[model samples]
Target chain A: MARKRPEPVQIVKQRRDAALNGLVHGVPYVQFLGIEFDRRGDELTAVMPFDEKLIGNPMLPALHGGAIAGFLETTAVIGLAWSNLWEEIESGRFDTDELALGHLPRLPKTIDFSVDYLRSGLPRDSYARARVNRSGRRYASVHVEAWQDQRGKLFAQATGHFLMPASKDD
Target chain B: MNPEKLKMAEQFISAVPHCKTLNMKLTNIGDGTAEMSLPYDLRIVGDPETGVVHGGAVSSLMDTCCGAAAMSHPSSPAGTATIDLRIDYMRAATPGQTIVTRAECYHITRSVAFVRAVAMDDDVDRPVATATGAFTVEGK
Candidate 1:
């Protein structure tokens, strides 16, 4: 007699989905912004569907600068959510039910956000990614970049600090 | 006073998608400053536990206000875009309270306009957030 078990990769993917689904569905702002999530292996990306309501200027038809920053910050939260779920899994504390609640305790609180607009964000679909620069017990800092067409020609970039739960991973 | 110009700024801002989504409105524009208001809504809550308005909403309010202020500025006034912005959340806005933002285009150079803003709910003295930003100044 033999028993089948899920592979580590499968588990990670499942957790990522749980976190992403929880975030996209549970968070009111994220849903209000019409943001979606995608995971390529270990990297997390956020995609905001082009909606005219997001435009800041009617003539330029460009996205609101704050919307761009909001996408970056929300992406950072998504990145942190996945990482937090991963950490919980490692510590044998991961819970599927908790994901349904979309509780804020599991999410990071933004302390500050600084954004740089490199180019005008045209009225089109936009993408964003967050790179965790440093993570500590009390806080996590992330560097975020957003682009419309080419990653090199970033429309906007941001750096933010969030108050996160105490992590034992150091 | 350029009442016609301020009307244009308000109209332009009213068309912004995010502004519409947030129900943001241009309240006033004068000299170097512009003001906007965001009425309370449950859809903008950041945390259900705290029920505070999302910081993103506040950020959008400031960005829109700053852009309007830059355009409304008597000097170097024209179309403008955000160059950079830094915001510090002093505290969360009280739930069920409208958030008001006042931004001033304090300085202007050949290509950039410098602006600062404060966001508050009921207490003008106790601001919920403060922001400093630089914006692109296009041809008048």
Candidate 2:
């Protein structure tokens, strides 16, 4: 049987709301990244406002690459947490905080992630988005892109692989 | 030379439940600088096919280096949190190679400290990634 996918625009709206409502907890750093969930569904877009704290090179005044990577990883997690599958994981019926820790069971843990620097992220507000290439019982794959908001410059790109935990009760 | 700075760095990393698995070690410290290394392990691979180190692990290492560098400053003793970090991936590291990072404190102001670091497999020229960061010195 084919699974129904939520509209991209609708998913964006839901994620934005969840972010605003603090559906994802213990993330005081989210505001530091300047990332806001703007839209959601099959694809998710995040907006990061410029902040001096994120500068990597004072000489070039460019956004740091570590900050860019953090933004990308956080975006991917946010998208997954907003997906329909999260409901089942979060339901108290599981009775395990570890299970409710926002990690999807049946997925391989994110053993590794890599980001390639195509260009310097300018010292200005920027945007990032991610698309799920594949989601399975054992792993989920995602591709992400980040761009400067002013000139729309491409700053960095990343691919993430997350291991999904198998359903214990099943 | 204050032991508090190194102790703080050790405490912060140890506090992180996830980082406990990395078993990071603080090997050396000096003026405006600090060094730490993560022992190579199979679990740290980002690409098992290529044996490339995971970016997140690299970032965590970079973050710790910067944080320790900030703590080296005399004015701040309470410790600092990673305000932000930017890393550039240069290439994949060789498999089973201990990754060493050397972070230097460039500037320390009233509330923020600027840091830069390089992660190398064994050769400095052939760096796996380069990073710059800002850390917030807490407790004014």
Candidate 3:
């Protein structure tokens, strides 16, 4: 009798999910904002559910600009980390089980973040995605766009440069 | 800042849900300038290893401060919204010290207002972050 191994895709997905779960949960601020991620392959979509506490202008009844900026920054960080974790997992350098057991990796530090507000953020659930412009050993640049209700219309966007965590060998 | 503007600024911050959530307080308001403070809170901590506040939190503080400054500007129309904001992180904020941000609406055109701000913890000499922002100045 031979034991059937899980498919390659399933194994990859499980590892990816584990990595994302750990990365997202590692940051206390991420948890504080109640941000969540939805992953497809290597891409990620960050979701911030609407809450009354997130409103910035009660008169206009809009989401706070600061809240939107924070969400965009969080998305960029998670996206960058996921890309690196995917590679590390494939190379067998990352231990998903240990991560699941509570060991977390150090997060990258933000050198700068710039946000452009295109429209007022509506008082509803918001979504964001990050695109990595550059990823190197020491530095990374990521761009993020946020929208609500409609994907074609963006309410806010940001570009952030981060100081990547030093690799263990270095 | 006049008494009317001062009262308006206070009421403005109080109406903001995010401000109340973070316990941000307006310390001072001058002509086209405002100072705000954010108390050290464990929930806003970013790095568990260092217990430092997140850059996002700092950015939030700066953004709100900038907006407040813009609103208080004499040239500012009825209201304002952030157009763009760029923040450069200089250092990590101390764990227990309150973060203070001071913003100035340096320039105002027919349609936009420009602002610059700095955030600091206990060490006022070395800033934690600096920000430059543009805000909408509608209905000149």
C-alpha TM-scores of all predictions = 0.91, 0.50, 0.94
Candidate 1 vs candidate 2: the DockQ winner is 1
Query: What would the per-residue lDDT of candidate 3 be over residues A27-126, giving only the tens digit for each residue?
Result: 8888878899998777799999998988988988998888888899999988888887777976667898888776678777899999999999988899
lDDT of 1 by residue, A1-170 (tens): 67856568777677757756776677777778899988776678899999887888778768888888888888887787677666665444766577676553357878899999988889889999988888777888899889988878888999988888665456
Query: Which candidate, 1 or 2, has the higher lDDT?
Result: 1
Highest-scoring model, lDDT: 3
What's the lDDT of the predicted structure labeled candidate 1?
0.83
Model 2, runs deviating above 4 Å: A1-41, A44-71, A74-170, B1-12
How many Å off is the CA of A83 in candidate 3?
0.6
Clashes of each: 2, 22, 0
* Poorest 10 consecutive residues by lDDT, candidate 2 chain B: B12-21
TM-score of chain A of each: 0.85, 0.68, 0.91
Q: Write the per-residue lDDT of candidate 3 for residues B7-112, one digit (tens) a residue.
A: 8788889889998999999988888899999999988988877899988888889999999998888888768899999999999999999999999999998888
Q: In model 1, which runs have C-alpha deviations exceeding 4 angstroms?
A: A1-12, A90-92, A102-105, A166-170, B1-6
Could you tell me the TM-score of chain A in candidate 3?
A: 0.91
Candidate 2, residues B1-140: lDDT per residue as tens digits? Answer: 45875676666556543345566677666667888898887655554445556565678678777777787766665656655566666777787888999999899888888899998987678988788777777783
Interface RMSD of 2: 10.6
Per DockQ, the best of the predicted structures is 3
Q: Please, what are the lDDT tens digits per residue for candidate 2 over residues A70-146? A: 67776665665445344542332322344345332322345345566666677677787777788776677777778
Superposed model 3: Cα runs more than 4 Å off = A1-10, B1-4
